[model samples]
Target: MEEIRKIIHIDMDAFFASVEQLDRPELRNKPIAVGGDGDRGVVAAASYEARKFGVRSAMSSKIAKKRCPQLIFVRGRHDRYKEVSKQIMNIFHEFTDLVEPLSIDEAFLDVTHNKKNLPSATLIAKEIKKRIKEVTGLTASAGISVNKFLAKIASDVNKPDGLFAIPPKDVEAFIEDLQIDKFYGVGKVTADKMHKLGIFKGKDLKKKSLLELSRLFGKHGAYYYNISRGIDERSVNPNRIRKSVGTEHTYQSDLIDTKEIKKDIQKTTQSLVRRLEKSDFKGRTITLKLKYSNFEQETRSRTLLQIIQGEEMIQKLAEDLLDQEELKTSIRLIGLTISNRINESEPMQLTIDF
Candidate 1:
């Protein structure tokens, strides 16, 4: 029998927007967003006040403004965010070396056997939350459970400044009532498919057998089957892995013509290729990302037999992917990315709190 693990997931509340408010007191208790406010600008983060009006991350600045005219926009300061992140990270290290940062503002910790030798993961989460506020003057929400998946989902239950836990005894009850969309990997696309299959909640998901799920969802079928019953055995890795390299260009105006979109993709791919060469990175997969004027985004990727990093090859693949689709929508951003190693070990699950 495997020893039951204790995991905690910590996520900063409205991270970018909160940082902006911390630096500018005038922006507190008011609506704010962080990112470019130009024609090609996208909202990287939205304050709690802004979110009340349906303003959100990845929304176009123009659309955000229309939704909330008084919304304040601030440029993101990555350096300052990094400085604060380091402080919070130090606190985690003081407790355990099993910290896995999902993003700058979020991380997972396996405290089953920590340096402090604490027996209760809930206590550690509470102390960590308190320490982060005292040191960084920012609020963070924490989730504690027996595994990484449960901890991550629990953390979001109480947003902004809250702590939630899912004990082993309550795991089944917790997951059974959880909605399908609340699952870690189930996004809008997956939720719709699950809905069609009458899998709206954890209970519904559990009704599907392993073979049926595998047939419907392919490789991810097994994942759903396990999680529906609150079983996630994945370990917490401390390594901060760099998985991919990519670049995106937001046009000043929507590129309606296929010729214009192709040109933009070519330029962006060339720049990424040069960067890849400089870093001596080798990858076999190429992904194309397109963001339409309405803020809808899509990605297409292809993996080849050999590691390829040629600009023409990347450009051609991107073009081919775009060519297969009808240009019905005007595009405001074009991007290309190359994925690196396929980790046969535990693949990282990175989540961003919206």
Candidate 2:
């Protein structure tokens, strides 16, 4: 026998832009975006007004403006956002300790057993939403369901200041009518593959057997099979930790010179070093990412016997990764990330048990 879980995913609406609007009274009811107002930078968030003009997060600021000439851009204040995040997270703690933050703006909370001893998760969601608005003057949309997958998707079903819940009884029908693109873990690339396989909706996805899905999707086949039927078993874990630390730069313009590229690598390495120092995280694997002029992306990584430390080793490996590959076109972006972090204090685990 198994127990059903009560999960709620809370996502702030256009967090960065909303913060901007909240702090600046004059900006309300106006189109605004938050990010670099430059040719190469990407939009981090778009106001509801900006969205009407087809502006969106991750769209280049240049194009975002082209979509809406009046789109006002503001630089992001991460510190201020983090401060507000702390306030809301405090509110979440008032309900349940099993709160797992997905990002700065989204989180999953397991309130099947909460501090308030609430009998209803929907009521809890409503209370949380009201409390957040009263405390931070920002709006958050919430989705309540039996599990993380459904709850996460449900959060987006409604827009800003919205609440949606999928009860156990309604889960199946709700999932069946859901479109394929709305399924968890399906992005543009995976959606294209699914569309080609004639899976345009949840019902279509359910038609495929696990064996067929596995053959097509490899390791994630079982995930799709389960999620398609409104089945997900992931628990809300509050103690999740970061696996990697990275920094990236979408260049102001494409870089054609190897010398200039190396300089950029050194600059990125310097920044990474500071972050690594701040977190005291050392990773054995260094991954280098590049985006060519055509927006084709490539990533290459190297693992070393020794944990990577200091700016010198970081720069050396970054340069080595670049040397291993020949640029097919002018590079538009570059990034450096490190993983395989060494947990010096954690005891080693046995490979087998008798």
Report the number of the highest-TM-score candidate. 2
Clashes of each: 0, 0
Instruction: Estimate candidate 2's alpha-carbon lDDT, on a 0 to 1 scale.
Output: 0.88
List candidate 2 segments past 4 Å from native: 245-285, 289-299, 302-320, 326-354
Per-residue lDDT tens digits for candidate 1, residues 1-354, read 978899999999998899889989999999999877876566778999999999987677899999999999997777788788889999999899999987788899999998988899999999999999999899999999999899999999989798999999999999999999999988776898899989999999999999999999889999999999998888899986767878787777788899878877766765676455433356778888889999899988888765666766787888998897786699888888888654435454555669
After the best TM-score superposition of candidate 1, give how far the Cα of residue 56 lies from its true spot, in angstroms.
0.7
- How much lDDT does candidate 1 score? 0.86
lDDT of each: 0.86, 0.88
Tens digits of per-residue lDDT, candidate 2, 1-354, equal: 677789999999988899999999999999999877866466778999999999987677889999999999998777788788889999999999999987777899999999999999999999999999999999999999999999999999888789999999999999889998988788766888899989999999999999999999989999999998888888899998779999887776799798999988876886676456434577789999999999899999998767898767899999999999689899988999999988968754445547
Q: Which ten residues in a row have the lowest lDDT in candidate 1?
A: 273-282
Task: Please list the residue runs of candidate 1 whose C-alpha ends up more than 4 Å from where it truly belongs after superposition.
Answer: 245-286, 289-336, 340-354
